[model samples]
Target: MTARPVSQHAAGTLEQALAMLAPPGLLVGCRRIETGDASHILPGESATILSRAAAARDASGAGRWLARRLLRQLGYGDLAIPRGKAGEPLWPAGVVGSIAHDADFAIAVVAPSETMRGVGVDIEPALPLPPELEPLVLNSRDRLEGCDVAIAGKIAFAVKEAAYKASFPLDGEVLGFEDIAVDLPAGTVTLSNGRRVGVGMSISSHIFALAFVPAGVS
Candidate 1:
């Protein structure tokens, strides 16, 4: 099968954006979802998406495709990342990571488990948060001041989702949107369990958000 050609311009832009949002110890990768991206899924990764629709499977495959590439950089050979019972990616021992994708892009971020206790990443369209969702996602504690008013709700929602992902592996508790609080200027999210996670974001054609819990921090 023929491989999709890489776009130098898009790659350069994504690299720049990632550098701005990634912490010092993280390895981040991004890819434009391509037609044959689903072909990258291995047997071990197939079960997770068996019940998903064709398009959803493609997105899942694209995420794993990028994830495997990042893991390879860490000296892990083409390992398959299975989905956890709660739907989180199950990374290899000694590593912590997250994968996220929207209609057009897929992103993955990884770090040594010793350096990062937990990490989560998410992507969404740059559009405004739906009116119905805004009520469900935002609360009095979230601070959106000094942010672009148009996408403020989107930012708050994305960061909260990232924070939930970062915290769930350690806490093993399912949390609601109201269970997370965000301070955009401070770039932090506080979970109801009292854990603090650092957040970073990039907004261009789409919104990309990342949350992390540093080792030794609770």
Candidate 2:
């Protein structure tokens, strides 16, 4: 089924949003707050937000903001946000996860156990690739093959972002587009470090593309 773009503040209600994003059998809940709210409150569960405007710094910044608030609500405590050697965000002990924020939305996923593994989430607003910049992002083979250039560029961007989050916790490696290769048709990514990761992506024609990956396993 084609993924639908969700925007209304009350789109599905907090209960419904949790139900839609959480894995089966996992209890989930969410609360909406004014951007000015001083604090977020949750006991021990993960929470995320899809903000309107002020909450997010930019399209992508919103996602990170939501993720941070969700972490706080989950009872993870204020994140120390240590910089990994590779400049990735690192959470305190007993936590393993990632956050993805975009222009109009933000999301954060957290798991109690390291066993839950590392998680990376990314979202990009849906837009046509700039004709002049397309060639710089895609290789000659892709350009000559008459493939879907726009989709290819988007997938590449998404995969790189996903890989950055997935691999950050392990060694804080800064990954570039050349360091990651994506097989969108197969929903897979191969890193220069010789690790292979699985990806799940949701695409809405006029909205954005969202991708997620669990940490450590790949």
Best by TM-score: 1
Per model, how many backbone clashes are there?
0, 5
- Residue 169 of model 2 has an lDDT of 67
Off by over 4 Å in 1: 1-8
Worst 10 residues of 1 by lDDT: 1-10
C-alpha lDDT of residue 61 in model 2: 38
lDDT (Cα) of model 1:
0.86
Candidates in order, TM-scores: namely 0.94, 0.62
Give the Cα lDDT of each candidate. Answer: 0.86, 0.49
* Cα distance off (Å), candidate 2, residue 162: 1.2
Best candidate, lDDT: 1
Candidate 2: list runs displaced more than 4 Å: 1-7, 10-65, 72-87, 139-149, 205-218
Backbone clash total for model 1 is 0
